[model samples]
Target: MNRLLCGLAANPALPPELVDRLIALAATPPGPSDLPDPAGLSADYLADLLVRNLSERADLGPAQVAALAALDEDTPAQLAHSGHLGAGDVDPAVWPLAALALLDEGRGLPEWARRFAADPDPSLRQRLASCAGLPADVEDTLAADADPEVTAELAWSTTSAPVAARLARHPHAEVRQSVAGNEAVPPASLAALLTGHGLPPARSCLVCDGREIPFAHDPSFQDVDRDLPAGAGCDGTHGSTVHGTWARALSNPAAPPEAVAGFAGHPSVWLRLAVAEHPGLPAEVYARLAGDPAPRVRAAVARNPGTGPEVSRVLAADPEVDVRRAVAHHPRVPFDVLGQLTPTTRLGPHPLPPISAATPEELARGAASGNGRVRMLVAHRHDLPPELRDRLAADPDASVAKAVAPHPGLSPERLRAMVALHGQQVLARVAANPDAPGDLLAELARHEPSARRALREIASHPNATAEALLPCLADGKSRVRAAAHPALPAAVVVGLLADPDPEVVEAAAGNPSLPPAVMAQLLP
Candidate 1:
């Protein structure tokens, strides 16, 4: 009974009388004699579950909010936290707990919270500091507070440049460290810390100059070979505060050229690697780092957007595969260099930007390369000339032929020809193409001992006709996909709800053709 009520409560189209009845039932717990409680859940517990689920409904209005609020103290808090009740709808003065919960959840605060900046409770001031768009006077009061934690919280959260600058100079190390991490901290202040000028000597790590700990202990750098120049460590043991401050300052976009230049030559390879990736790096500094003994540093330089053509060409032929791969995608890499590197470069999930901008002649040259991998790269390009595409489609290599089969621009005649030549080899790719013709998809659907994987793609193809999908419903391999096809008759979709296979039933339930009335009935 509770399950049925929970389902009905979630239905947006549920009648108003049903909603009122559910709320009334929640107010009065069911007696032992009222119904069989097969689940053995207590009446009070079931009532609370129903009320909470009802509170989640977006359509709840003032009347529903009031009724739920009256059922229990927590319901009002839940209603306010759910965001269904506006400030005018629920009076915070009447339900103070609801108002406090709103503040704790980081939901919009009440206007009265403005006074919290000077509230005697430091925690309250700290919470108020985290809120956006605080009044200027309120902000000033919090920034001047005696509590370092309040100032630290403001330092980490503040967008105002002046507040960050002031906090950067705070005598307390914690507050200054927080300011160092804040994006709005002035570049000069970050530079000062990076250069160890304004930073206190007590905060400096004696063991490794704030460089060894991250490389030795940080998981992000675990793959880095410890034998590298950066890891010739005296000891990995050190306080994190000092090292963290320098790292955060170095990563800041506002980091000054002086700080960046200082870090480039730092003894720690980790520091040099960080500076190499900085987008605002000066050209001369970038060029200098390109020759860094560390391959990872060279790789970072290759990946840097500011790396110029000369540096790109240099990295293109570097001994390290990682460095070559990184420069292969660089937009500034010389065209001839990119052509030389394509055969060995593996395609990652991200498209190669440089190749996308390649000239037709360059693309043709790549298509005609002796290596199949080079031809495979050419086949992936969306702008490949038709003459070149057809020539590659007939390539002796099956993998190269498959690579070009899915190009949406492939003409229908070419798609058919590929299927006739390769048969099932290219059938799945043709079916997956968005531009695959309906007649071809229908023919593929009826092919003998059909490509099991291709049938699934054909079942969901937008161009699939009713005839194509109808046959799929009988094949267990494609039944679930067929059940979900929008082209399936509404009657057939509804009938699939009773399928023995749970997957098919779920697919049927999700089909848009299933009537809303049937959907409500099918719930639970």
Candidate 2:
């Protein structure tokens, strides 16, 4: 009886009675081990059946469709490689089933589907050419395809602005229509198209999270006071006149120079700050922003990569410490300017002892200072003597010990010795420390699972071995299992998929390296 039912499920052209029985089986509530073998045959056998089902236009109902969809992820690719689907040989009626079975689910286009991007069948090409997460190279090829129908899909699906621009001017009206309605079309393109056609500027705004703003621009526009007094302006409410301009101006990449110049003096600091950060702002406008009363605007000006070196020089001397810091990190700033700026080091209230002034002997003396802050400063210096590092490693203070743990100058043996001597609190620091050695990480992995916090940190440590992470997979804490999931091998993750904790299962699912067979088991 089971064999008869399985045969009918695989046979799309069987008599009506057999087809009805297969539909009834699909509707039946399946038992745990009695789960229907989507195709009650081997994968290779099922692939051959699908090719024949489409080759002859056999009557198959939706239940038959569901059964076909239930095939494993690899089944579609197998059929494609067998030359049944892609060489313009498969019947058009079954293209939908083939597309669904082969849909690469957040992965890029399937290896087989690339051949069909320009397939003679318009429907086939349209079904496979998805814009969602398509790789850049594949998207480029499809965007430039000779077929208007194929490239029209690019207008709606592609996130690439340049592609959208090309589609906007496409000779085909349908392709242009798709570009017109596409939200990804930049505001500048929309503005140009509207103006060229002598149409009025769109009263509806397209800036609020890419949706059309319902309210018209306020005719009696008033700037919100810099010191916002209660409910005076776009306190983030949708309709405020100030809010409309703010959203539109930010979205308009080609916002005119006059508007940017006007915004530079707008009463709202946010508006001025945005103008200050605009990459297209003229050098003179940037110079003006350098001295804006708002320190934030000045800071934006200081950090804008396009800001001239002279402007950066002025900003380096700005009274605001953050503005000077921004200039210090600026790429164009001369070495002399950066050297003149105060080092942003914060190990202590006092500055680090300069190499010119303080010998390693003097710095080592500082490291021995009873003052914890002074010792903390010495702990940060790269020039510390090897003996001094060992002393700092054994420092009773947690802060001193942690500060020393990450110092790359500390030898691996010194780190391992410190891990053995320090309390769990310091152990946490060593586990997270980037320069912590593989041997020390492996040892820390052997430390008791009861140190959940330390174990969690060790699970994420790049240097921590698979052996170290293996124990944490069964840890009582969810985060430990979560942290260990990414580092574990595929076989380990397969075992973890059945873990009682839903959180652990989720973490396992997130591992990109999970095998397809394991992933099939994990499917909802």
Candidate 3:
């Protein structure tokens, strides 16, 4: 190689294609020359550039992806030379690449997955648990790997059936906890896991307890407030050892009530909150939590199904509406408590419309409510009868009208007439109903101009996700065009950055939907 070309290979900007061209052009190698100081290069920027550039290569293959994944521990210098090329830099470029790497890297992958799976190394195992594309068949290896971490990772995949069963019995309490807490594991499965427990929750530890130690977490589940960016924070600390404990509490719901009560005074509210809200907490525990000073703790009590009607009745009378909202939704709050929920009313700054329209009792009670939500509730309840629906149909807030639009007890004909009889606001609720009948939209067009506009907008939208209103991008409607323009496809949206309208262009450029390339073009 020409000595100069060899020196130029160190230029970060010189793409691989450029290097090859220079190498082919050079005829001779020179005396020993030092390679460029890779340390001088910005690791992050170089990593991003190389990854982006190589990821797009269509000819990229799996051997390449595996190579990059392996180079994870190598320095930047080793990486550039080992052109034994793993999927170039694209191995981590996209979720798909990671998935591809998992599949392409054969079973011979360093026994890390097995070792890490069983590893006492919390950091290694937690990272692996969150890793994409773990092999489906890895369960057997993991189950036998003997590290609580490895077995926990397998249990966390939760979807792995074979792993789930063994992990349910594995000697470690934390491993079993991961199984119990896994969303994929059904409540029934959790019931089964609870079958053999002796004490201390599911606390088995290969590293610690052989016989005397009980399987367990701190009685109160605590969230480690590692203000550090995710994946950069600490996990729970047990004994003298320190490792990542982020994914450790996988199946804690099956933990016993007494175990949870043990942590009610935990220094961290996160842990207290966890204990307060844990499904395993029996009614007495949640009721005991009813007077917790933090609103979240009290809210947890209000929400727990275990709280009996007597306790729920007392909590419903608490001043906080948040507590009240919880009461409204609570399964145990009997009708008597629900009746007490009718917040008192008397006209003030926000005068509610007259009760003249509602049937006598609801109108009287609703007219008295100081809270609009309470009044709105009275206006909506089925027990109010038909005459009341007509009276409050004129309530000033658009939200109030929409809230009343879909009473199952109200006849479809009545709902259709309300669309025409009422103004624009009812359209939002009608639109929210995926199964809304055509007659309602037709009536809306006849009665409300704003409603007609919404209908036309919905019909013309580019991307029609169930929640998507018409995207206005290149479309002519200024407000809608602004909303829709940003959500355009990357190739198309990037092209839209040069659009003449500032609103259209700005929306496309600034919109969350426009990807990086489009944003870059728009910004610069």
Candidate 4:
């Protein structure tokens, strides 16, 4: 067991499930004598060895570091005081690795790591930032580092609220995304970042950055689009390229009401439209926004989940066809309101975004529409009627058929026949269906040599048998090799752990069926 535990610690490629098991075992009580302190073995040597085991060659990736970090925090301190480890005994070259080992054990790094925690070298600072459970002061300093990469790493890896707050306003989008993803981020800080607003245009524009001049005298700063008439200036061409700060923030469910409220009066119609749809928004705010002069904003309010029946009634009578259509489709709108709207009513702006999740009846209604677009909308619905699905499956429109081809409702015979007819496009979905019979899956797995996507889907399907999975192990696609790992036998997985592909090896290490002897073999 000791050897297996140590092996797991060294092997970074192990899957999350095995990592979890290792964490549990590490927490279990071992007899005081069970911890073998071999005679003449120095603690610093053991520490160095542990750090060395965490290198890329040993599979000590981020996942392993994080999983190990969650275990009891006493491991590092215990080892440091165990008479084996001595101050300055650790090699200077492996200081960063030493810091990671201490962090995984939930302890602050000793003299070496602390000394260089704020080192001018960005790489060294980045290494320290990646360590979880570092001293608050150390983490806070790293969070404020001018190097965005260091700050970004700290944002992603730190649990310290102060550190997260310090980096909340980082200029870099990647850094902000990291801060937003951290659970420890303050609600106020998150809200501030989430509020939808446009910043002043940057120095360079992606859309305007490159344009081949038609001639020396040509005066146009527009994207190259053959569809546009020559000299159609960049104006009114490509829309705003500014980041969707509000949209990204609203994606986080933890966003505070105050942050959302910040966007209530934003000038951008698109931003206002997003604000109208925010969940649990104040009723008064909803009422105020419901009356927005912008048709798009009103349409958004009409479709918003928080829009009350009273506001929806006003929208039902709105002059704009898009607003009326939004109200008509709104779940909260009265049946009378829906009955009043004609099928000719426009369904909001072009390329309409999904305002809300539709019910089965809405899907059925959409499926029955003569308009191909409405029927296309029905194709995205999860619970289409059997008759509608079958009809759509046979629809001459390729997009509609493509959408319906993946439906699990199709019979095995139908799916099998579809594979031959539809070819690669639908084959992946057919292979993914859990209802697919074992024999059919095996046949497809063996005979279907083409379409790597289908092969991957087949390899990962819950119904895939050992025979079905065997071919996937040798599949050229790394995704297929990884997906095939769980289903492979113990002997097969042991060999696969040494697979050339990092992802495949990672998957193999995570296989639950790995033999005890094989696991022990991976130990340092």
Winning candidate number (TM-score): 1
Candidate 4 clash pair list: 12-59, 42-84, 43-84, 43-85, 44-85, 196-246
Supply candidate 4's per-residue lDDT for 497.
63
Q: By lDDT, who's the top model here?
A: 1
For model 3, state the Cα shift of residue 496 in Å: 7.2
Candidate 2 residue 416 C-alpha distance from true site, Å = 3.7
Instruction: Give the Cα lDDT of each candidate.
Output: 0.72, 0.56, 0.47, 0.59
* Worst ten in a row by lDDT for model 1: 225-234
lDDT of 3 by residue, 1-524 (tens): 22122223333333344433433332122223523323343334334334333333333345443433343343222332333334344322232223223433431243434544554645555556544456665456555555576567657665665556666666665576556656555444444554433323334343343423332334354424322222221122232111111122312564545645666665656666766667666666777778778878777777666667877787887777777657656654564455576553221222122222345764556634555555565555534556666555555555455666654455556566556555576764554334445444334434435544455444333333323333323235534343333333456545555555433443443344655443332211
**TM-score result, candidate 1:** 0.63
Off by over 4 Å in 3: 1-137, 143-152, 158-251, 265-267, 342-400, 406-416, 419-424, 431-524
What's the count of clashing pairs in each model shown?
A: 0, 0, 27, 6
Give per-model TM-scores: 0.63, 0.43, 0.46, 0.42
Q: Judge candidate 3 against the unseen true structure and give its global Cα lDDT, from 0 to 1.
A: 0.47
- Model 3: how far is 365 from its true place, Å? 15
Write model 1 residue lDDT over 1-524, tens digit each, in one string.
Answer: 34445445654555555567777767876676654434565666666767887888777767887898888767887887788655556555566456545655556454645656656878667866776666567677778888777887888888888888877777655576677778888887888767768654433232344364443443345433232233323343334555656766776778887677778877778778878888887799999999999999999899888789899988887889999998976765666676677666665533366667778887788788887766776676656777887888887766667778877677788778887777887777778878888888888888776787788888989999877788788778699889878888889987887787655765675576766676555433
RMSD of each candidate relative to the true structure:
8.7, 13.9, 13.5, 15.0
